[model samples]
Target: MQLANKTIVVTGAGGGIGRELCLQLVQRGANVAGVDINLATLDETGRLAGVGRDRFAGFQLDITDGEKVSSLPAEVLAHFGVVDGLINNAGIIQPFKLVNDLSMDAINRVMAVNFYGTLYLTKAFLPHLLERPEAHIANVSSMGGFLPVPGQTVYGAAKAAVKLLTEGLYAELKDTNVKVTVIFPGAIATNIMQNSGLDVPNADAGSDSQFKTLSARQAADQMLAGIEKNQFRVVIGQDARAMDKLYRLNPKYAADLIQKKMRSLLR
Candidate 1:
């Protein structure tokens, strides 16, 4: 979709792929309402955007708050007078642990942000999106969404829901002006680990998976192109692409192999 003059709301706009997507959207002539819970990080994103104030704005929001999420479309419409796109990019991976070891609070928090947050935002914006000739909804799923990554079962489950949700939305929205695209990204060097209060793995000493990591900017670029072409699925990073292919070829074998290979990484 043409981004010029379009108003797009990007959740989790403070870090990683979200931040990169925000900058690229502005560069492509889109007016952006960047939303995140971290006010300081949001400020950094705005500063890095370097676009004039008129072209971009930032808001601090906890995406899981249904009331705030429901109110966002109206607020953005008030600011930009129209809404053309929504990017459900806000997500969290909390307290990496086995399911039995995971606390309910951590699992709930992850589900709230990654699943309900995306659902709330999408439902809130669908009506406004339907008003436009063409609109787009881009959801950030994960490589774990398709295959259970050992360390984060709850996170994988939430993202898996997002993947299905996006696909279902696409099926339902077909023959309409709105488009839905889901992204599965492999490891990108992001602050998600620190933000989740987990030790960031030593990239240099880790397995070859470390070498295959993509930059946040690279993933964001691929996402933009996928949305532009209305692709149903976009896999980012080499690891994600390979895993996706492997799963497509043999789901059970891939799952079992991953379970055996990453048994140690779960901790």
Candidate 2:
């Protein structure tokens, strides 16, 4: 769907891909409701959008709270008068460890933010989206969602759930006015470790790395292009595209390759 003159809601708009998306969407003539748990950073997204309050509004919200998420559509409508799209981008990663070594609390938190949060916001805004003449829903799922990453098992599992959930929505909504797209992004330059409250080695420290990480801006650009084209799935970065091919051709080899390359990061 064309973005011009549309009002779109983007979760996790405080920073990273979400922030970049907010800025780019405004440039395409779309009004944006930037939602995040961090009010300060969410406001910064509006500033970066370089638009007035009429075009960019920031809403501080914790999407994991179902009640609060359910209330967001009304609040956004009150500000923008209509909703044309929803982007489920809010998610967190787990600590680098095997599943048995991770705490139940950590596992649950990852699932809550990555999977359940997406579900809550989608259900809340789907009815409103359906009311529009045309609408779009774009969900961000990681490459780990499709491939196995040794140290991030829970994180991968959560994203995998998001992948299936988004695909199912696409199939069910095919006859409707709403369009759905799921994104598989390779490693992008972001402070996801800091956001998830974990410390990690520098991403570029691995000299033999096979993966090519994209910048946040590049990822955001790809996402917008996918949404505009109404694509069923979008794989960002050369790394993601390569892995998509590998996994489809040989799932076991793809899993082993990622495990071999990423094992050092877990150390």
Candidate 3:
């Protein structure tokens, strides 16, 4: 799944890791169709990529809308002429509140964006990917998917669903031309809170020592590398890698450890 000259579609291309992925993919000689709800920011992504219209196209669309998502592949093909890969990267976090204190609307919104949005785009683009000689699909699940954070219960659940959905796709597509890769990312330095319409908190306000977070560019690099190698699972950042191992060895301990550290951050 070499990226050179390939056409890849990436959601959440307006900001954070998604924007970084678009930039790096263009550097690898891939034609990128960057999708985001924010048209202005998506254009900014294209500007940062420094690629002309021939190499990059930005589409403004809400991924949670099935009709819009289903229409994306054709639009991408019309712009790039072919599709080689799809990256489901758009997602949102829950309000920093306990599940019992959270509204059902908030919980459902998280699930819609984090889980259903990924599913819709994957389903829409999967057939096109299978048509290619060697195609790949990468979905970004969070470290919260594997380790429970007290304040982000529903967000974690949504990502965990994505994790399983990606793994299951890998199993089903094992004999097909399409390759599947699921990513688990630790905290990354990004404006996700702002993007999700939430306020930012002081980094040192909580009792837990601030964990080392990966940069958006670093996470994007790791994701592309994983897709290139046709890897089954890619965990970004040292914190995520450590938790992956810990969760495997002792899920209870891993959950408790995160709860101890993050509970103070919960409202």
Candidate 4:
């Protein structure tokens, strides 16, 4: 679906790829409802968006709050009048620890933010999306969702759920005007580690890293392209694409390779 003249809602509008998505969507002629836990950062995103108040509106709310999520559509409609797309972009990573060593709080937080948060936003906006002549939904999964990462087991599981959730939504909406896309991003230079409250070296953007990572803007660009083209699935970055093909060919080898390369993060 074309972005121009559309009203789109993007979670995680505070920073990183989510911020980039909000900026680009508004620049592309879409009215954006920016949702984030940080009101200051969400407003910063609006400032950086370089669009008028009419083109962008920021909402501060935790997506895991089902009651608030259920009410978001009405609030968004009050601003943009009609919703055309929903991008489930807000998420957090779990600490770099084995699941056996992690707390249930960690596990639940990961599942709630990454999986249920996406589900809530999807459920809230889906009806409005369906009402439009053409609508799109894109959920950002991870390469970890498809291939195993040693220390981030729960994070992987949550993202894997998002992957399936998006795919299922696609299948269920195939006959409707609403289009769905599931995105798997490999590694991108973002502050997700700091945001997730983990300060491990090489977990995010740092000079010493196992693989090359894409910039947040680059990742956001590809995501928007996928939404515009109504792609069923989009794998961003060479690392994710390579891993996708390798996993398809030999899951054992892929898993072993990732375990070896990612084991250092656990320590």
Backbone clashes in each candidate structure, one number apiece?
A: 0, 0, 0, 0
- Per residue, candidate 2 scores C-alpha lDDT tens digits across 145-252 of 999988889999999999999999999999999999999998789878888888876653446767667899999999999999999999998888998999999999
Candidate 3 TM-score over all chains jointly: 0.97
The whole-model lDDT of each prediction reads 0.87, 0.92, 0.91, 0.92
Report how far residue 156 has shifted in candidate 1, in Å: 0.6
Evaluate model 4: give its TM-score: 0.96
Judged by lDDT against the true structure, how good is candidate 1? Answer: 0.87
Off by over 4 Å in 2: 202-206
lDDT of 4 at 133: 94
lDDT of 2: 0.92
What are the per-residue Cα lDDT tens digits for candidate 1 across 1-267?
Answer: 877788899998999888999999999889999999999999999999998767889988888999988888877888789889999998889675788898898999999999999999999999999999899999999999999767688999999999999999999999899999999998887888776667865433237443467788988888988888888889888878888999999999889877776666664
164 Cα displacement, candidate 4 (Å): 0.6
Q: After superposition, how far is residue 62 of candidate 1 from its true place, in Å?
A: 0.5
